[model samples]
Target: TICGLFGFELDNFERAEVQKATRRLLEHEKRFLERGLRNFLIYKDMFLKSVYRAGLPEILIYLPIIESGCSPRARSRAGAVGLWQLMPSTAYDYHLRIDYWVDERKDPVKSTEAALKYLKRLFGYYGNWELALAAYNAGPANINRAIAMGKTRDYWILRKRGVLSRETSWYIPRFYAIVRIAENPAEFDLNIENAGKKFTFQVLELEKSLSIRELCRRAGIPYSEIRFLNPELRRAITPPGRRYNLKIPAGSLAPFLSAYHGIKKEYIEDVAVYTVRSGDTIGEIAERFGTSPSLIKLINGLRGSLIYAGQELVIPVKEGGLINKVPIRNNFRNYSSLISSSIRYTIRRGDTLWDIAKRYRIEMEVLLALNGIGYNEVLMPGNEILIPVNPLLSP
Candidate 1:
């Protein structure tokens, strides 16, 4: 394989390991891998330009392929986010905004720039691409400690010494494997399609915060399209009281500006702040506000359905009896039969019925009906409850 003959030579053990990892990735996630490659191709120009401008090698473009499969919204279990998989602290260090209204780590262009800057620093510290790549996965301190203990800066040596975490140990090889296969898809018998047009957008500076749905309406585009263009925006509304750069479809800026100015001032204030009280859950608050729990979490930066007392959340409310315009699919109606074939969920510490309902993406009313529990029922740890099995809901 080209990977074994490339910039970093692989020993027999390493070659076999790389081949095994490549095979596993190809066999188990071929479609997803192909989609990732397609996504990479879509942003190839952006990646190349960003890397070249940073004075980094073009191969660095493949980093996001391994980090996030080219998905801007990718988030890891450890709270690392975006295509570059930057943790919150690293993102903050890079000056990427992470707040209630937006998480800039999920912005494709901004995060790519931030990641390139960070990678350059890592490379300068290590003086070797392999070591720098390893440090990118594990912290620099960990890599430095490993180099000190192993008395060598070679990443392979550290891997052999078992000085890196299992994930970090495989990171370099996996990256190499992805690069090799991507560089020579035919050699690996893989078929990757073009991702059509390159992603292009124009930034419109907004004087006041506007509901994303309203922006979409004025732009004559679907809400989903605007959301796709601006993945960094976490809420239905943009943050208030500041000039925010809003990305819209190319050439639609003039139309958007004209339509935006025509909107009524009252409709712009569509969001309401609600302070969470004791026994409050995201689902209950969402229900009260005529919004969805998922939207609340997105707006407030809540990772899961968990909400604590005294936490203030931004909730989108209906305007003039018009339904909340965020176009989330109406899946609540499907919950009645969905819960008929259910599974047991053990109540954990601080568990609430609303938490369980939100986690499973079911209506709280349906959850109450399933377990014959009341709306205000108090839940205790270790109590087993019936939870609906919905494939559409994320576990």
Candidate 2:
């Protein structure tokens, strides 16, 4: 209400722009409106108790409409993300860590707290609720300058001055229209559950830094569900440090904590170099390395798989070398001199001997020859294999 009232102080143009934006939202985002309302209802108690305290439910409902339309894993073009749409810098200011392993902006509960803090601060800065809402939509700095230049605190006056962009000017009205529809979903053609459901969680305290894979193993929980619970963990692994709270399904906490330490941590290696050539694709390279294109993309910081001829790309590999490098063997006495060394590796899941050989830039026959593996021998996990360390191959 305060945020909306602030809109009254805007210039005629600003007010009209807000109205136009409101019309656009009412027309374009009908489904999103329903979803936002549903989520608010679902998280009603938690939203009210943890964040809003005494704020109007409509204000709480307005968040997802402005954020990600209630998409839990929504990522913006600017990289501001999650249900609350927090930017990285702002997430950090609110103590939401973004690191190799985790990004708390994607964590709904954590991000809600951060978003509320930001909203509250904005409200405090602009006493007029409409101005606060406008500031939230555009930014306080922009609104402040607009008010100063117009010599009027009216949002419509500022809008007439053309200080805010079309989208931002209308953002508040859109928010208001959405609130109107959200308050009474049945009035529209939309027919679905408006009442929110309850979500329960059990706090998981880590005794040691463990990968999500291992956590799932010990807990008898699926990785999909684990990801749902701990979206903050970016990679499958949780980084080492002080124990942080991990939310899990309501019932599994006790059993999970009991065997959490017993599951052996299997760390993946992610370092490799691949030569560019005539026909190389990110998907192909990823398949060859037994990883996903997204992982490769992330590790290499690739914009869009645009590569040039003869370019060298760094690839991720299993952490430890599977095959041990062979030591130097004696040179031939008859000829001038030739020496070689080789490495050994154990077969791992999803690994082919050919793939392994190509990874180290060695011929398939050479790999088979060095390891004394039979042509018919099936590669089994943990089977010892040898790898030649010499870059050159004998003719």
Which candidate tops TM-score? 1
Best-matching candidate per lDDT: 1
For all candidates in order, the CA lDDT equals 0.72, 0.60
Off by over 4 Å in 1: 1-14, 194-197, 265-273, 276-395
Report the CA-based lDDT of candidate 2 relative to the real structure. Answer: 0.60
Model 1 clashing residue pairs (backbone): none
Candidate 2 weakest ten by summed lDDT: 330-339
lDDT of 2 by residue, 147-229 (tens): 88778776656766777677666666676666555555666666548543455578887644456666777778887777776
In model 2, the runs with Cα more than 4 Å from the true position are 1-23, 53-58, 194-197, 265-395
